[model samples]
Target: MDLRQLQYLVAVAEEGSVRRAARRLYMAQPPLSQALLRLERDLGVELFTRTSRGVILTDAGRELVGRARDILHQVEDARSAVQATAPDDSATLRIGAVAGPLSAGELTRPILEAFRALHPDVTVRLRDTSFADQVDLVASGVIDVALVRCPVVHDDVDVIPIAAEPRALFVRSTHELASEQTLSVDDVIEYPMLGLDAPEWFSSFWQLDPERGHSLVDTQLPPVSTVQGIQLALAAAPLVVTGCATMARFAPSPLIRAIELPDASPSIIGVAYRRGDTRPVVRSFLEAAASAAAENIALLPNATSSV
Candidate 1:
């Protein structure tokens, strides 16, 4: 009935014990138990099956858990929306993006600059994170807005396509394949492949097989940083990397070249946030990203850029 009851119920369901849940919720066991009882009474259903092994969700409990999580998420969103309206004194916007900026052929400065202009007091903290996990992070109030690659399959979060840039395969200029107009999966398999630090939608397209002659020369390198991946590929044989035109423009190495694979489609880069969050600052940042994305796409390396 009350938010506390729902909160207590969720804690118990997660912790699987009234006593443990109480510890996690920082409350006494008896009161937590009473809250659950009251909730079950109001709902007119048994939510959990109690045992020494800990609580097991009854069919009803399982059903309620999903709704409870949604409810909690909505509550958190509402609270955040309120706080975000009046810019905080901290003036910090915590944003996370898929780590490969140079390889992805995208630039984030336009958005960062626009946001800084409006909220000069607001410092943006950008972290290299996974596109896969970012949706949940935004929905759970972990990050304000996540720069993610499409297509997202979640109903709880909303994604706005900010840019669509071609995916490129980077190789050293001296490599045999580097001179070719385009390359294929088989053509580059024999060489050591440098992969991104995090998985994007395009990762599945490569489909490298270890048993089928494509051996991983190194796995110990940090797979998340684009800079690191490029560095590793430069040192190794036949490094297969992906990026866009924007990346090639800013690349530090003259030896590195971006080549387009006719089969490799352009990846969709987007801004993602909680579906229901209506904060003005968040909205302003989204607009800025959209605007910057439109201009930056033109700068990204196209499939036709001289490799």
Candidate 2:
């Protein structure tokens, strides 16, 4: 009935449990439960069906949840637009980027230069982040935008394709696959891979398979989830997987070589900003990125989302 109730509805729908949603919202369980009850009563519809594991959205709930997100995004846009009636002359855009391509200056440099050329007065700041954390950073407002690899999931962000980066399978030089000049997805999926402790969509993007990813937690394969996991990966690297053809620039030891995945589609490197964020500076940055991309990588646009 109100924005508060809609927010409560979305939180519960997304989390699939009242208790989990309450914890995420930093609120107590009782009030949240009452709010859900009140919302259901007002709508005269059962939004959720409770079960032993958690709450599941009913048909009505499923229909309303998407509209609720759109409404929230529009409300945010109105608020941002009102607040920006008088633009701040000294605005700083904080950009987050994955370490590999960013370090190699393959994905971000031209866009950054183009942005600077267009918005000479604005200040730009950079932070090194991984594709794993890029979306969360933008969604949580930790940064203004992110340079990330595509085949990524962005249910709550807008990703604009800027360039294409080739895909390669990374293996330790001594690994058996290293001798192969070209490989296919079928060739690599059988082996252990460095499980990126990332969203399922992101972790699975490299494989080009909706059902497969390096997320088997019990496997002996080292992960890229933490600093210790990274260390373990360096010591005994597994099949390092695809999409990050420039990873060797940041990683050391055990020696790695990238074998061409001649059949795999190249990943589209893009700039992702929170969806419905239509601020002028954000627009400027996007336009700059598009222009730079057109002149540089000239990649075709293919939009996607996990949800």
Candidate 3:
């Protein structure tokens, strides 16, 4: 019925308990429960069924929760749009990037330099985020644009393909595969791969699924949420972390070795923004990014016969 009610519904659905949701929302349990009851009464449907453990969403609740999330996202976007146009802050451009490969100097720095060259008056702000969060940030207008790795299959955002670079397997220099000049997707999959705690679409792209029959090996290591997590995991074991060649070029870890995955398809990088965004700054940055990608295409990793 209202944004606050929708927020309460979403919080309850995510937290799975009225008491827990109340704690998360910084509100008392009674008021939160009362709000949920009022919402259900207005809608004439039972949103959740209470249990001793926690609340479970009824079939209608499951459907409504999805719609509620979308509505909340739009509401947030509207608020951000208005704030961006406030008299004092109209000249700022917000950019979001997934940690590691795309955020490195090789890709991000050049794009920033080009955009700034064209728009000297705008102040650019960068937000480093997980791969899973990049798309959401763009869609919710939290950032004007995002530099994201591909297989970004969301209808709410439009993606412009920038560059396609070869994929590599990163492992500790002391690992057996580290000495090899080239490896196959199959070879890399034999090791316990370090998985990322990212959206399925985002994570699947980095896994070389297209080249490897969409199969990834199991891992005992807990899933990592950021690039640093992947690096830390590699330092601790003989695990495999798949990424673009640019990552190998910029890595600070002397113990890490990036071996060419000749058989795997190259990873693609793209610029993503909300579908209907026509802001001049966003368009200018995207154009600059595309130009930078074109100029650096020759620098991308080349495929070779597996050794």
Query: lDDT per residue, candidate 1, 1-307, as tens digits?
Result: 8665777778888888887875444334554677788888988999999998889999999888889899978877786677667555346677877654532344577667777888897778776765346666787777888877544534456677766666566777777677777776556556656655433323333324321223353465445345545645655655566555455566557777777654544556778787766766788888888776676655554422111
Q: Could you tally the backbone clashes for each prediction?
A: 8, 0, 0
TM-score of each: 0.54, 0.66, 0.66
Better of 2 and 3 by lDDT: 3
Those runs of model 3 whose alpha carbons end farther than 4 Å from true positions after fitting are: 1-90, 210-219, 296-307
Clashing pairs in 1: 103-243, 105-244, 197-223, 197-224, 245-300, 245-301, 246-300, 246-301
Off by over 4 Å in 1: 1-90, 100-107, 128-142, 149-157, 184-202, 205-225, 295-297, 301-307
**Candidate 1, poorest ten consecutive residues by summed lDDT:** 204-213
- Which pairs of residues have clashing backbones in candidate 3? none
lDDT of 3: 0.74
Clashes of 2: 0
The better-scoring model by TM-score among 1 and 3 is: 3
lDDT for each residue of candidate 2 in 74-146, tens digit (9 for 90 to 100): 8777756764674664388988886634422443567789989888888998887864687789878788888
Q: Supply the TM-score for candidate 2.
A: 0.66
